[model samples]
Target: MDWDKLRIFHAVADAGSLTHAGESLHLSQSAVSRQIRALEESLNTTLFRRHARGLILTEQGELLFEATRTMTKRLDATAARIRDSEDEVFGELRVTTTLGFGTLWLLPRLPRLFALYPNLKIDLMLEEKLLDLPMREADVAIRMKEPSQAELIRRRLMDVRICFYANADYVARNGMPETAEALADHRLITQSPSSPQVRAGLEFSQPFVAAANHSAMTVNTYFGILQGVIHGIGIGSLPDYVTADFPDLVRVLPDVQSATIPVYLAYVEELRHSKRVCAFRDFVLEEIQSFRRRALPEAPETGHAMTP
Candidate 1:
């Protein structure tokens, strides 16, 4: 198999035109056509069907194209890794985490990370679905629960629990509920049980849903619930980590909380020595430490303890 011919075929198939592929590869259209013809002869199969509009891949071409596409992505990733210096942490780092943590916690702290590594490129993927780290779906992940995926290096970052919270203004207007039974009088805001969330969060929120006699609002993401609480909507079930970022939110029902869920940071074992991955891991650990320190005490006026 000729690597050059395969490369040319991939480009032409991708572009669906001889001229376009030639322009991309800096070759004459005739030269590209010749290479494609040679590749077809070598494979003893028709690779493409030429139409008036452009070229379409034959079944064989489609199969070859799929292999080439995967090869190209892997090669690109390898090239990026090779380009990274041993000491300098600068490259595209894809980080995936739940939408709530990404928006409420990690997003706020990214400016500091960027300030330190000005050349670093961060591709933040915020979703509840776990990306396949070993398959390179994402470079790193911070998951609410310990990642069960194989062929990965995992580190427990911290533990978080869900608790009830409401804006100070909302509390002032409606008064705070000191007991679970008293929650019946106030509106409840929470993540829907059907939504993708940690079991601990769902468990904490279920009691509130059952107890609320007034109107209730159910959002799919914690970000939405946080926003509702910020605007004085009602008491919401939120992770304790959010207290550090939102000092004005008053913790209600201090004794009621969810069992702590372990938060884990994980990446493929192959990336253990990668400079970008190491830098990100260290930065996250340091930031979490700082967050923990800040969350030790409540803001002077909020009159409620921050989540631990």
Candidate 2:
């Protein structure tokens, strides 16, 4: 089994089309097909069932895929470990962020980073889904979560203070609640993972517990929830940064208290001391610290900076 040839075949199998795999590998369709044929001939087994639409893996290919995928991941990680020698922060850096942040923040400002570090390559992945870092799916993940794991190097970048908000029309129509207890009159929209400690900290005395059971519509995504609230479906707890910037939303209960959601920037420690990784870490920390300092409404000056 030639390792490189096997790798090409693996790409073809995963992509389901030789042309797609070729595009990914920066090779042509004929070259990839020849490599696949050579690999099958050497193994003396049929790997793919050819079809007009695309290729389907045979039982042999399935068995091979299970091993190949793992090997590819290991190979990628090993390569990163080896490439750690490049002290200039050169080569591709894969990063992932949430949709709203990606749209309003990261994507717009990425050009500055590019201008600052011309040598470092960046691949910014924008999805609401959190990516696995250690597997090399993404080198970094920005998420709203309390950091608990050991394998990751977690840094609490900011406390995403969330408060209830509604459109001005909705607030005007329903009237504003004076206290947390009075919020039951308005439709309350919220999400879970609100630990007991957080609720206690917020002094959430609101009796809108019915909102938990009879939510207008249950959505798993923050963007959808925000849209629902913006359209007058209900009142939603939006991040202060988002609310502070969003023109259409208005904070209804600014005094009732808000839940502080810990935002974390996490990465696999496998490349902890690597020069490129270190360069990226330092750059991200510097950028985020500045962003949090300048942007966050309640950010403290000193201890508020996310410590390692």
Candidate 3:
């Protein structure tokens, strides 16, 4: 009910220390403590359990803090929307994507985006865990599959094929594996079978796992696997898009590849009008087009398409 007290309580709960929260809010510790006490009194319950070490939120405090957190995010979203109405794209845009695509595909092309919008701030969150879009976990996401979450504005960027790759020297030394049986002669470096990756990638690598004579060295991230493959550790399973950037890595079995893994770019419906989101979406689309041109120079230049 009291916005000021709620704000102070949220800060204290977030920081877990009255002194730290007071410093952040530019208020005295006594002032912050008084507000928290008043809030607890008004709510008729204990908000925090004070200890010599720090403050810990009680069950009631946790509930109130969750409410305040939601309120804070909504207010921030409103402010961002208001700022988005301006002509400048100059705020933090949190973008989430898989580790492999973020490091291999997106990071390399981000310079062009920075050149276009010099003031834009990008917070690239690279991990396999799918963040909650509508809850504002991230501003945008480039994912390996269509997002199952409703109320999201999603666009399919491209389809990636995961396949076997090896360092040129490794292939030169061991020769290429022409058949599934031939894989038995070479060591395999790939994403851990237990790691979270696209279904298509996992399915494509299963037979190779069984066929490789040596037990695979499994890295959790594609970047790690790529490094292993680059250093001549062994043949690796990786996205086909990698070859366009990594020239020294050769496709292990040209005839064999994974089923197409659809890549989708998504954001909350609330950001549909945000200039930062628009700038990022367009930048990604243009880069995907450029990547396609480089990957297939002979293919007729049918420009990239957007699905509603």
Candidate 4:
């Protein structure tokens, strides 16, 4: 019922010590302890269990902490929204995407974004795990597959395919594979089948593994595979988007490729009017468009539409 007491309790529970919470909140430890006691009396239940080390949350305290955590996030979101100006794009924007795409594609292009909005802060989260947008785990996402989350405003960015590639020197040294069967003589660099990756990419890479007789290297992220290929280790299975920046990589066994993986950009519906979200969405869309235009002619002919 008391907002200040609830805030103090949340802090104390978070730190597991009244002294630590008090230091953070600019209050004396005794004052924080008194507030917690008052809150426990108000709720008619024990909120914490004190021991020689620190306080542990009682069952009731756990429930209240969960509520307060959610409240804190929602309040932070509200404050962020309030701080955003219609004409100025500033403040933190959390973006989530697969590690491969984040490192290979998006991260390199972020300088242009910063050039436009010098004050903007970007928290780039690169992982295979999909973050929950609606729950505020991440403010935006660029995913290989269409997002199934509700209350999300999503846009189709482009279609990407997994293709075999090798550095020019490696190709010159080892010779290019003309057919899937020819891959038997070359060392293959690829994401391990056991690693977390798109089903389509895994399915596409299976035949190559089955065909390879030479030694192979398996890495969890596409970035590692690219590195292996760059250093003349082996031919790698890589996304087509890499060609724009890594122009020296020669497309090998062009006919052997994966089905199109649709890339999507999505954000929570609540962020529809948020200027930062709009700016980021537009910037990504523009970048994708530019990439498609520049890379299309040089892109190996898979005899399929690569654009959305």
Candidate 5:
């Protein structure tokens, strides 16, 4: 019934694991368990059915979740309203992104963000795997592919162009490709293999000759892959924005045969009205828009135009 208990309940419901929910709330596993137990006892119903992975909500828990969600939203709105009156942006903002984007783009820009809002703290979570924002692992997410559903809010920040790049040494030794079809001639470094259809985020028209994991001089991290490409290790398909600063890593070919990717800034419906969330969201959008304008002068004229 209390705000704290409801918050813990929501966390348990979302994370489905004590350890994860505890990490999100900055509480110990025992503390989280106690809170949830107290909450269920107060409610006089079996809210959760504990399992090996975590706890699943019972039918009553599911029903109560609807009301709890509404209550939490209103409570957050009230807090935000008070903070606005006080003229302070103070809260924890959980953000998620991929390895490359997280290391290359976001990590460097965080100092400026802290200077802008001294009271606000940021929790950055990076995963190769996708995260569900509505479930509360992340407050904001930057994803590559287009959002599947129309219900979620998404703003395309950039028309991400992809092409092959490699270090000067690798290119000098193995040689560079003149066309997209010519990439087959050289050695290629990659991270972990994806689905049978996708390899290193590229779907080859023909077949690829060879690949490597981390040990094969193939790395998965953005910085790692970029370093390999810079050192002339091997060629790999990478986002143009990712390799823009590294002069050592040059594009293999000028042609844009690789798939067009989008960099998106998205959040959950629950945080639509949150001041801290919206402030950061709007700031990122403004910055990205300026970057897009500078980077893609003829974006509309070209086939790489972004959709509304």
Candidate 6:
């Protein structure tokens, strides 16, 4: 019931030590202990179990801690939104995207963004799992497919195609496959079909995996597959975007390509006017335009859109 007690409890639960929590809160250890004891008495439950190591949360404490954690996240979100009202594009912007795209494409281009907004703090969360933007899991997302979340402001970014490529040395040794059927002769490297990936990419590799009698080296992330290909492990099914940076990768079966996977940038409707979000959106748009010009000269320009 007491806000201050809840705050102290959250800190103690987080740090798992009275002294540590006290140091962070700028309180004496005895004061923190007294508050914890009083809060436990108020709640009529044992919140923590003290031992020689540190404090361990009781079942009740775990439940209370979860509530306090949510409260903290909401508070942080509010503070971030309040900070966004200022005339500067500064503060933390949590960005989430697939590991492949984040590392291969976005990470490489981040220096330009940092150059423009030195005060900007970016927390890039790279994974295949889609985070809930509306729930404040992340501030923004760049997904291979359009996000299905409601109340999101989505903008179509670009299309990616899964195509076969191999290192120049590997191609020189194994020779390029002229047809889909010819791929049986060479080792294949790719993301596992069961891994979380764009449908188009998985579908593209299916036939090759079957042709190789499931002998392909499958990895969970595109970066792993890229490394395998780079080391001459095998011809890899990779997104076409890699060609811009990895020129040494020779395209195999040039006529064979996966259906285009649409990439989309999305954020909660609430963040539509956030300066940090605007700066990031604009930076990505500019970089996408530049990328098209350099890497995909023939790809038509697709302007940004505000779709549900």
Best by lDDT: 6
Residue 1 lDDT in candidate 6: 96
Ranking by lDDT: 6, 4, 3, 1, 2, 5
The list of candidate 2 runs beyond 4 A from truth reads: 19-34, 74-87, 100-111, 118-120, 126-130, 146-149, 167-174, 187-220, 224-234, 247-249, 255-260, 274-276, 291-308
Query: Poorest 10 consecutive residues of model 3 by lDDT?
Result: 299-308
What is the TM-score of each predicted model, taking all chains together? 0.82, 0.71, 0.95, 0.90, 0.66, 0.92
Which sections of candidate 4 miss by over 4 Å?
16-19, 49-56, 298-308
Model 6 clash pairs are none
1-308 per-residue lDDT for model 3 (tens digits):
88999999999999999999999999999999899888888989998998888998888888988999989988888899999999988998999999899999999999999999999999999999999988888889999888998798888888788889998899888898898788878888778888889888888888888777776788989999999999999989899889779987888778788998888999988899899999999999888888888884653443334444
What candidate 3 gets wrong by more than 4 Å, as runs, is 297-307
lDDT of 2 by residue, 1-308 (tens): 89989899889999999999999999999999999999999999999998988999999999999889878877876787778776565777777877656665566667777777788787789775667776668887777674456788877666666567788888888787787656766677665434222343234423355534334444444566578787888887655666434668877777754566666777787767766667666766676666665566467633243435
Instruction: Give the Cα lDDT of each candidate.
Output: 0.87, 0.71, 0.88, 0.89, 0.68, 0.90
lDDT-better candidate, 4 vs 5: 4
For every candidate, C-alpha RMSD to the true structure in Å: 5.6, 5.0, 1.9, 3.4, 6.1, 2.1
- Give the deviation of candidate 3 from the true structure as CA RMSD: 1.9
Ten residues in a row with the worst lDDT in model 4? 299-308
Error of 4 at 128 (Å): 1.6
Q: Which ten residues in a row have the lowest lDDT in candidate 2?
A: 193-202
lDDT of 6: 0.90
Candidate 3: the clashing residue pairs are none
For residues 177-229, could you state the per-residue lDDT of candidate 4 as single tens digits? 88788898899988999999999999998877887889988999999999999
Off by over 4 Å in 5: 1-85, 149-151, 180-182, 195-200, 204-206, 209-218, 269-273, 293-308
TM-score of 5: 0.66
CA error at residue 30 for candidate 2, angstroms = 6.0
Clashes of 6: 0
